[model samples]
Target: MKIKQYRTQFIQELSPLYDAYEAESFFYLILEEKHNLRQIDVALNHELIFSESEIWVWNSLLAELKKEVPIQYLMGKTNFYGLDFEVNEDVLIPRPETEELVEWIINENLKAQKFKKLKILDIGTGSGCIAISLAKNIPNARVFALDVSKEALKTAKKNSENNKVDVTFIHQSILEIDDLKNDFDIIVSNPPYVRNLEKKEIKNNVLNYEPHLALFVEDTDALIFYRKIAEIAQKNLTENGQLFFEINQYLGEDMKALLEEMNFKNIELKKDIYGNDRMIFCNVSKTS
Candidate 1:
């Protein structure tokens, strides 16, 4: 069968699971990855035909797509912050809101007209997206990333190497770290902020395929990571060091309160492109 016809059948078959646009995009993405055929290539070469094995492989992927596995995981890669990173079930796929978090960190650091070098640590750095993006873009910044799961760290390590960014990947839980080298100019995290009750709010593709360790917090203690990180920020951050978080939209006010109560100065809660409160910024005191 012709590739275009196959793609049309793919969309029709997946229409129950995804919209026409999404299914169409999936068709093209698979075509590109498996056959090196972009949408235009497939369209231009209307006679392009798949071999028996190629057809079998495509059918296998279509079955997985119907199961709602994220396409990034299926392709084992994702583009984020203008860079491509390896992704798998081991790590949560890098997200756009987190890209906004990266933008906030990089742009804020640019505003500092200081003579001192900057150091950054990204807690819960899954896929190394935030840390690698920052390290690649921000010159002369010492970047380190931490994740509790060894499986997640494997993907992050690969991402660091692939992106040619020298990010130190550490296998440790942020909640259990007793001490960290001080004077870090910036600390950022996109930790697990989704509440258990919000499971219904999550898309099927995510809930079914993504790593839960990197997605959920108990509903009663949804801010556990943020609170713990804020406490550590007091001791680990530089004098007036900045802190940033990719936060749960529903808990922005609560995060602000946690930082404020910890005596974090200059606390600012900002919304993402969608006008939902998504990232939080604050600075710790030099002396307290």
Candidate 2:
């Protein structure tokens, strides 16, 4: 069958679930991945055809897409912060807001007069996106990533290696530990901040397919991970060390208050490109 004809059919079928633009984007992504054909190639070559076997494979993928499986899971990979990462059901797919968090950390540290040999830790580092991005961008940083689930850690370890960054992966839960065992110059986390009551706000593709353990908190204790990690940071962060978090958008003021009560100085709650309060930064002041 002519590939362009299949493309039209693909988009039409998916338009109900996703917009025309998104469905078209998905078609081209699959084309590039499966056939090594770029969008330009497909546009220029109207006669291009999908072999029978290839059609079968694409049909199967289309079925899964109809079921609302994420395309990243279907492709078994994704791009984040200009690097490739292997993603699966074991880890949550990296998001653009988290990339903003990484950029903030990189920019803040890069402003130093000279790059210091800095120790950094990423708590609940599913897929190791933030840690690896920081290590890749900040050459002098020694990065460590910790996650509770063994499966998630396994994926994160592979991602660090694939990105060719030396991020030490720790298979431990942030909630279970009292101390990080080593003082770090920077500590960052994009931990579970979604409350159970907020589940209705989540799309079916995420609520049904993504790892729940990495996404949810009790409605009564929405800041559970943040609180636990902040406590550990109080003890394990070096004097004047910085901490960063990708927070739930609705709880920015609550996050600011939490850090203030914990004596974190220079608290800065910033918005993402969408202008939602999505990230926060603070530094521990030993003297305070």
Candidate 3:
């Protein structure tokens, strides 16, 4: 069957699960990944057809899509911060909002007049996306990533090698650490911030398919990870060092209060492209 003909059916079938735009995007993404066929190629050549085996592959993927499986999980990999990352059930899929956090860090570092050889740590680094992207983009950065889950660290390690970035991977939980053991110029995290009460707001694809361990926190202690990491940052961050977080959109004020009470200076809450309170940056005071 012509690939174009199958595209129509694919979109229609996924429409019940995703919007028309998202469903259409999934079709093109799979086409490129599976067949090296781009949208223009499909458009320019009306004669392109899927072979019998290729059709079977599409049918299998479609079946999974109908089950509301994430396309990224089905592909076993995803593009993040201009690098390809291996993702699976063990790690949460990288989101665009987190990319904005990365961009924020890179931009801030680049704009500084003195280019210090920086040591950076990423807490709860699931796929090592933040750590690898920083190591790749900033040639002088010594990057380290920490995660509690050994399974997630395995995937993060592979992603670091695949992206040709040198990121030290540590297997430890932030909640258990009394100290980071080294002062860092920057510490960043996109920790699990979703409260159990917010589960109803999550999409079925995410709620059902993504790892809950990487997604949820107790409703009463939504800021548990933030508080613990902040405590460590006070002792471990260098003088004038910066701390950045991809925060729960709903808890920006609470995050500010936490940092302020800890004597973290220059706390700034920045919104993502969609204007949600999705990121925060704070600096350790000189006197502290």
Candidate 4:
């Protein structure tokens, strides 16, 4: 079949689940992943035909897409902060908002006049996207990432190597760590901030396929991970160190209050491109 013919059928089949634009995007994503064909390539070679074996591969992915499996998972890799990251069921897919958070960190550091090397820790690093991105962008940074799941850490380590950046990976839960055993100029986390009650608001694709352990918290105590990580940061952050979080949009006020109660000064809440309150930054005082 000609590529355009298959593209039409592919988008039509998934239109019931995703919008026309999203479906078209998925088509190009799979084309690139499965056939090394970009949208421009397919357009230029409109007669490009899919052999029987290639059709089989595309059909298999189409079936999974109908099942609401994430395209990133289907591709087994994603681009974040201009770096390629290997992803799986063990890790939450890195989002664009998280990339914004990373850009914020890099921009802040770049604005500083000091030439001293800075230390950074990414709590619950998951796929190590943030740590690896920071290390790759900031040549003077020493980056470390921690996760409770050894499986996630394994994927993170591979990503660090694949990205050609050195990031120290620690397989430990942030909830259990009292001190990081070292002070960091920056500590950041995008922990399990979603309350169980918010499950209804989440899409079926994410709710059903993404790992629950990395996505949820008790409804009654939704800020458990944030509070725990903040507590650790209190002791582990160097004087004037910054703490950053990619937060739950609904809990922006709550997050600010928590940081204030913890004596995190200069607390700032920022919105993402979608205008959602999705990231926060705080600084520790030298005396406190």
Where is model 3 more than 4 Å wrong at Cα?
A: 111-114
Show pairs that collide, candidate 4: none
Ordered by lDDT, highest first, the candidates read 3, 2, 4, 1
Candidate 3 per-residue C-alpha lDDT over 40-118 given as tens digits, one digit per residue, 9 for 90 to 100: 9999999999999999999999999999899999999999989999999999999999999999999989755255788
Colliding pairs, model 1: none
Error of 4 at 188 (Å): 0.5
lDDT of 2: 0.93
Taken over the whole model, the C-alpha lDDT of each candidate is 0.89, 0.93, 0.93, 0.93
- Which pairs clash in the backbone of model 3? none
Query: Compared to the true structure, candidate 2 yields what TM-score?
Result: 0.98
lDDT of 1 by residue, 89-183 (tens): 98999888889999989888875625566899999998999999999988888999999999888889988889898988889888897678655
Clashes of each: 0, 0, 0, 0
Give the clash total for candidate 3.
0
Model 4 error, position 37 (Å): 1.7
Least well predicted 10-residue stretch by lDDT in candidate 3? 108-117
